[model samples]
Target: MLLEPKSLDNIIVGLLVDNFFKWYVAPKDLWFLDRKKQADAYIKKFKEIGLKNIGNKIEEVDERKGIEVLDENSFIEFIRRINKYAVSTNELRESLKLNLLTTSKQDTFYSFLPSLYVNVDKRELYSLYPEPASYEDFVPKNWSGVYEDFLPKIDWEEKYWYDKNGIDLLNLENNRGKK
Candidate 1:
């Protein structure tokens, strides 16, 4: 289903927030040097490597272009780029400091998604993908808990089930009850 412009904006913001948090709390071992210095080095390395090599492997799977698969190293590089180019360093530092002060490591505040499906028979909720989504899919790997506060409540009695494509199985008549 098409998302309203505002909904799309929220999704983007949520993604940014989640990514920033992940970047902030990443294991120190991931960067051999200090955080800021490591970020600077990665940015330089990314520039030397060039943009042609940076992208989601899934998007380039067919062509098999010389795309460097986004592993931990690439993730760090991209995070550094965002930190250096997208947001001001002071702003990012303050935001991260505030986040660390107010939010717990286990908090699910940064998690966000467009939808999830409920399986009444199993009494379970899951994403549309058969496999769990990854960072490459723009879905935060560490996010947890349901986003019920903003999303519509599921009508469990309706016994609705959605396919991988997000089509509601029980309500195919007018497709009015889609998740």
Candidate 2:
């Protein structure tokens, strides 16, 4: 239940720090147009706009009273936006090169949690909730075909069969060697 940002981002940040150690010497400098402030503002805006689908946590610094520490999601989004803008302006790719937004396998899995984007294999609109998870009469508005043909059919067995005496009827020991 407790999820931490993937190690890849940490590695990327470490690399970035190593490469741009001089840039961080002055935290107030705005060479990249006050990126830290922008990140904080964007996080606040996203939270305000009710787009907090991705969890974000900010650690507050004493001097930076209202502002909070940047978490991976906000940082990554900042990088993504910067990259998009840079590409639009025909900026050299190397100029905006950063690996902070690189998604790892875990990020990919978590990305699918809030919204699903699965390709329908055969097409009867599938509801991925509930159980044997089927309701034959309930057709979705956008009906896609089903992959029923590919589904492995289940051979059901009674997991619990209670007899009149309220005991498991399938227990072999109940009908032992006497017979």
Candidate 3:
């Protein structure tokens, strides 16, 4: 999350990046393979935080070095500080401003890897140890409330692929029995 920062009055600062990952990437089930092994793998992945600069260039950050994890009390304070930034200051009805963050309360958007926004979605997460991907989850998270195998984004089936004889490949798949 944060490499190092000074104390904020009595509260410690810096807990965005790691906590965000915990909320998402940290698998809810701990009883697969082995507990210690799975935890180690998860923590190691969290250490490699993704960063994208203003230029949209992405990079990997090892958050483990010289970093401090947030305690329960400090974490609550951190969330409060974050929420203060999320309050929408720009009234969309009055102005034509389209920047979503113009009215957001997040003080800063940590450009987690593969992301350009302060809030990183699951699609932006890169796995160091990737599990075998099932065809079912290819449609990306933004497609709906859940990951689905069938993506409306895919339009190839609608287009025709012709063979040497000009027979459509798609029709051939269905016309297998009819000579």
Top candidate when judged by TM-score against the true structure: 1
Q: Each prediction's Cα RMSD?
A: 17.7, 22.9, 18.9
The estimated TM-scores of all candidates read 0.20, 0.15, 0.17
Better of 1 and 2 by lDDT: 1
Candidate 1's TM-score: 0.20
Clashes of 2: 8
Clashing residue pairs, backbone N/CA/C < 3 A, model 1? none
lDDT (Cα, tens digit) per residue for candidate 2, span 39-145 = 55558778898887543343332333432322222333433322312211111111112111355434432221111111222223222212231322222234342
Question: Can you tell me which runs of candidate 1 are displaced by over 4 Å?
Answer: 1-6, 9-68, 84-179
Tens digits of per-residue lDDT, candidate 1, 80-165, equal 44342232223333443454466653231232122333222222233322123311222122423232321234332222233445
Q: Give the Å shift of residue 18 in candidate 1.
A: 14
Clashing pairs in 2: 122-145, 123-144, 123-145, 123-146, 124-144, 124-145, 124-146, 125-144
What lDDT tens digits, residue by residue, belong to model 3 across residues 1-179? 11111111111111124424211111112102122333344455555665223231112122212212223333344344344222111121112122223533221111111111111232222221122321122222332112221112213222122233535332323433222
Best-first order by TM-score: 1, 3, 2
- What's the CA error at residue 92 for candidate 3, in Å? 8.2
In model 2, where is the ten-residue run with the lowest total lDDT? 21-30
For model 2, the local distance difference test gives 0.25
